[model samples]
Structures are given as C-alpha cells and as structure tokens.
Target: MDWLRKLFSSPVPLNDSYHLSPSYKVFTSAFDQEILAKDLERSRKYAGEPTASADRTWRELQQFWATDLALLQAETTRLAGRLQPSLNLPKSSTLTLLIDHSGSMRGDKIQLAAFVAEVTVQLAIKLNLPFEVLGFTTVEWKGAPVRDLWSAQRALSNPGRLCALNHVVYSDFTDGDHPNSLRAMFLADLLKENVDGEAILWAVQRAKAWSAGPHMVLIISDGAPVDDATLFHNDPSYLWSHLHEVIDEFGIDPDVLLAGLGINYDVSSLYDTSDTITVFEDIHAKVLPLLENCLRKM
Candidate 1:
C-alpha cells in the first residue's frame, strides 16, 4: 500500500546549488568488486583487434589445400570464396550507450545496467572507437532530458581515462560526485515513477550531431515506455508510435543500430525493427553473449 502511494506521489524539486563534477570516478565499492573485475576481463577478451574486411585473394583463400589437391588432378578446382572475419565491426563509428535509470531499474537491475555500461566504455576505448554514454529517467530530473556520463568529444580526447569503469551505483539520493553519479542519485530519489523511453530518441539525436559516421545505440532497461507526463492518454501503443516517429524524423534508421537489453519485461516491441533485443536473465550467461554479438555487428 505504501509502495503504491509513493509511486503516485509527486517528485521533489531539484537543488539549484547541486552541481555535477567534470571529473568522473573510475571505481566504486557499491557493487561486488569481483564481479566487476571479471566483467572487465571478459570485455578485454572480446576487445581484440577490429576484424578487417573480407579477403578474396587466392593467398587468403580459406580452402587452399582442398583447391590445390583438386587442381593437381584432371578435376576442376572449385574457387574458394572470400573469408569474412569473425567480427567485422565498423572502424570509424560512434557508440552511444543509453541507460534507463528509471524507478523500475532499482536494486540488481540498475547495478547490472551500470556494469554493462562500464564494460562497454572499456571495450570502446580498447578498440579505439569514439563513444558517448547517457543516462535518462523522468524529464523532471536534475539533468533531465539526458545526462552525459562521457561525451564523444571528451572520449576522443581522453581515450585513456575511459579504459576503466567511470560510474558509481547510486542507492541513495544524495550520493552525487560526478555527472553520472548525480543522474543515478536523481533516479534513486524517484525510484517508483514510470519511465519515458522516448528519452532514447533525444540521446540518439545528440549522438548524430556528435558524429557523421555510423552510430550504434544500446539501451538497457527493465520496463516499457510509460510516462504520464507526456502520454496523458491511456493508450499503450502511444510509446511505440512516438518512437517510430522520432526515428523517422532523423532519417538515419539504416545507419543507426538499435539494441535493447530488457531486464524483466519483453522490450522487443521497443525495438521493433532491431534484431538485437534480448530479454535479460543472467548478466554473465545471457546478456554478455547478446552484447558481444551486437558489438561484432557494429
């Protein structure tokens, strides 16, 4: 009963004096250090040199031996097709991470989302890829609209700093150290409110302006888009239609890749055209594989 009451309650006003720091913290004791370390190691293993384009030359033929044996005899040798690399990712592209810091993503869900974001930043830096990390909740939050954890410009200039996880788990409201932490704090404060998934479109628009090359947006969330502030009507399909309109406005649907990591609910609808929306079960066993596969595609 209390939980339901709190869910419908209005959010408190933001503090004007509170400011998010420019420098971010690389480590935090809020989460299990061992798990974080293992995830980081896994990201490193997956961050091998970006695969080159397919090589169709005879020297690089995949079935050279078989072809030679057939050529020696009177039998005609079948030409071996080009060997495509295991992971042919884009060399010059922008990687945008959109984390859902809504009330539903509290407890273990939020922690896992942060871990995924952390590992992604590390992997992007390791591969020398330009990237941006953004966290979004309600539009009424302090950094409302969207909070930038690491901007594309900052990432390109100080790639070395991004090699480590620069985020903290905010289980409390007053725990604001960096911009990312501040966003987490705001999310914690309003931990029972509905989320606005359309915030992702805002982040995507910002990322497009940041880079002209190909862009990949990965959204980590637990629930569907349900913002009473914007969608006053009781239609459930409004979120879906709104998202499609936003994507159409950009006109970069093909160039932009959308991937979703749904925590509990089936968020596949949120990414209707995406082939990479995976329902979350276990982070290490389920989510990691999906994330790696998406990265390979990028």
Candidate 2:
C-alpha cells in the first residue's frame, strides 16, 4: 500500500527535458549475459568489434515496434493467410491492460503508462479482441467501474490522440504534500482492495465463457513499490504475496494467461552522472529480461 501511495502522490513532471540514457544499452536480456559469455569465449581468437544491433536484440526491437497496433494488425493479417495453427495460434479473444502508477512515476512513468494503455486498446480493437483498460493507483471510484474504449479504433486515428487521452486520464491526480509516497499508497490500496482482483475475475469470466482461448494482461511500471514509513505501516510484501491466490481464485491456468510487464525509462541513481538515458537503459537491461523470465515460468 505504501508503494502505491507514493506512486499516485508524486507524478513526474512531463515538461522536464527528456533524453534517452546509455545505461539502457549496457544492460541485457535475461539470456543476454550467458549468451554473450559463450559467444565471447568461442570467438576469443577473432577479437572483432561486436555489432551494436545483434540479431537477437534486433528481433526484440522489432517486437517492440510491432506493438503499434495498426502496423501489427496489418502484418498479422498479411501473414495469417499463409500460417497454419501449428505455427501461429489465433490471437486471444480478451486482453486486460494494467498500468502501475506507483511511486515517483509522476512524469515519465505516467506518460509511458498512458501511451501503452492507448496502444493496447487499439490492438484489442484491431484484432476484434474484447478488452478492458485499467489504471492502478490507490484511488477508488463508485460501483464496478470499467472504461469502455469500444470506440478505440476511432479514437486512435488522429496523430496525437493518444497523448490527449493520457492527459485526461492522468489529470485526475492531485498534487499532494507527500506526492511520491501518496502515489505508492494508491497502488498498494488498489491491490489490497481487490481492484486488480475484480479485473482478474472479469477476465476469467470471459475466458470460461469462451471455453478454450487465451487471456492477456499487460502491466507497465517502474518496479519500485513505495516504501513509505506511515502508509504501509511497514508491511511491504503484504499485497504481492496475495497475487497467486488471486490467480488461483479465477480458476485459470496461471501460465496460459499472458502477462507483459514493462519497465519505464528512469533510474534513481542517475544523479551521479547526468546520463539519464544510460540510467534508463541500465535499469531496463537488468529488470525487463528478469520480468520476462518470471512471466514465462508462470
């Protein structure tokens, strides 16, 4: 809860000068370190400079860019004609997007979350995937609230429409005395109050109704949970431990339901050297691949 509180309360300043840091480049995927070690040992005699955009990294980069829904849908449609079920499983029917607005993500984190949310919705529409859009912070709304972007196709047609959606969705955040901690608490409370739980429930309901199909949930965040003294009352792991139970209650195979976790472009330790881009890359290299591993195991 403390983690969530900090996320909500301290929104990052969007207008601040933005730059990509080199730290992101130095880091590698979960398989990167081992693969690099093996390749280095094999080629010790050659001593040639390594290419910047290796094949593996190029594939990941392609996947990242393909996340843009219109392009993805067009490509998928073109390829689906030649592909058999053995090679290409049909796209899932339902998708749930969860963005964590927790702790010090006020500026960059929030912006990215909102951007991804918009893309996820567009993809859902393009593929005719029934989808739910959810934003997680500690805040509560009346009734079982779900924003239906059924018209997401229409909304995404404009060039800068995604940015406008982000502004309105995140504008609800009010500046607080302890903005960082308060934001974290919002996310924490969301977990505690079963907001995410309810979303999971609806997802399972959809999956069961379809009988045999996959469901996806994509989560975007900078992994730090708020570590507030007062809000969490210091019991930090309380919510994370409940995540499995929440899945179990839904009666869905944990591994089959896809979950994509994205790390944002920010590093707390970047102050030492003004290389913000490097910091973001460093954190992404360390964290994203780790997260991918965990998701695969699930």
Task: Give the top-scoring candidate (lDDT).
Answer: 1
Candidate 1 off by > 4 Å: 1-91, 139-187, 190-197, 233-236, 247-252, 272-281
Output the worst ten-in-a-row residue range by lDDT, candidate 2: 159-168
Candidate number with greatest TM-score: 1
What is the clash count of model 1? 0
TM-score of each: 0.50, 0.38
What does candidate 1 score in Cα RMSD to the true structure?
18.0
- Per-candidate Cα lDDT values, in order, are 0.43, 0.33
Per residue, candidate 2 scores C-alpha lDDT tens digits across 51-99 of: 2222233344335655453553454354333332323334443555555
lDDT per residue for candidate 1 within 257-296, as digits (tens), equals 7777676666676553232233222543554455556565
lDDT for residue 243 in candidate 1, whole number 0-100 = 53
